[model samples]
Target: MLKGILEGCVLKVIFDNETYGYEISQKLQEHGFQGISEGTIYPLLLRMEKNGLIEATYKASVLGPRRKYFTITGKGKGELEDFLTVYKEMERAVHHLFAQRKPEADSEENTGFGEPEWEG
Candidate 1:
């Protein structure tokens, strides 16, 4: 589950802008995903490229090293859309599960620990 979520996040980051491995890891960390290593990201990137969700090209970097910049494919955009749809539904369900409900005001029975008391 977390892997899929991370993959979606990676796709989203690439969708926003083309970036290389280290930059992508930094962005993920900056966005509150701490402890994500380059090792993890690189493999995922390779997998996504192989799966046709993304395409990578070598570009000259200012730091004097050739960087593999990743861009989302048309298929990736479609996958991202599908992820958004599923994510929204999951978000709604989680919100609904945690949402507080107002208690009955006119009940005469004692409510124990915030639970409605059963009349025997």
Candidate 2:
């Protein structure tokens, strides 16, 4: 489940800018996705590459070895669009569910299902 979400996020990151795996992890962390390590991102990148969602090119790195930079393919762009559509729908449903539940929970507390209301 989370992997699917991460896949969409990684594709978006790549689509926005062609970058390497480590840099992708850093960007995600900067965007509030903490604890996303390169270890996790590498396999996802490999899978996206194999699935034809993204393509990689090797570029010389000033640091040391060549780095593999990723770019989104046509298919990847389409997938990202689909993912955003579904994600937005789910997000709305989740918000609606919680909004509806909050009133119910408050009413239950006032009704004294468990702890009694203070009233003092």
Candidate 3:
């Protein structure tokens, strides 16, 4: 599910500044990208490069080996903009569907996936 959406994820991360692969991976990990692995991240980077959505350049590190850094291209920015539309629509639809139910008092702590206290 997230495989096809990584372009958006990668672009979101780099929208702030240029970053190396390892840094990007660490950031994604911190953000709770559930299925993302280092193996999965690079290929998406390559594919994004192939599509001209992002550009990668290598730089020497002072304390370590050279690192490949990725930056979001104008095309990638435009693609992310497009994704925002789709993502917002999806979010709205999902929220609308789920918002119809009332949450149980104790369910605020549970997301209703594994250990649920909510009826929805």
Candidate 4:
């Protein structure tokens, strides 16, 4: 469900910049995806690395232990592009479906659930 979408989102974030786990989670929250924990992010990062979509390097952190920073590989970039294409098609399809629905005014008129019409 959400995990599937989050994988693509994680890829996009890594594609945008090389970052560590906590920072990646923070970026997800900043982009309106709240409640995503570092625990979740780490597993996804590991999976991506295993899949060869991203590469990681150990870097010293000023605050604490060495951080494993992720950078998108060439394969990752290609996958991201594919995801973008699919996402855009889904977006357009959803928009078209919603557009075909009757407007609120029409709904109210037919359903008799809105304010009463007054005769002059």
Task: Give a tens-digit lDDT track for model 3, residues 20-82.
Answer: 777888888899876667787888888889999888899999999998888898988999999
For 28-107, candidate 2 gives per-residue lDDT tens digits of: 99999989999989999999999999999999999799999999999999999999999999889977765564443566
Model 3 residue 84 distance off true place after TM-score fit, in angstroms? 1.2
lDDT of 1 by residue, 1-120 (tens): 788888999999999999889988899999999999888888889999999999999999886889999999999999999998998899899787655344553343443224446844
C-alpha RMSD in Å of predicted model 1 compared with the true structure: 5.9
TM-scores for all candidates: the values are: 0.79, 0.85, 0.76, 0.81
Best by TM-score: 2
Candidate 2 clashing pairs, residues 3+ apart or interchain: none
Which residue runs does candidate 2 get wrong by more than 4 Å? Answer: 102-104, 107-120
Clashing pairs in 1: none
Looking at model 2, how many pairs of residues clash?
A: 0
Q: What stretches of model 1 exceed 4 Å from their correct place?
A: 100-120
lDDT (0-100) at residue 68 of candidate 2? Answer: 92
Q: Candidate 4, which segments miss by more than 4 Å at Cα?
A: 102-105, 109-120
Indicate the residue-level lDDT of 88 in model 1: 88
Candidates' lDDT values, in order? 0.87, 0.90, 0.79, 0.86
Q: Give the Cα error of residue 83 in candidate 4, in Å.
A: 0.5
Clashing pairs in 3: none
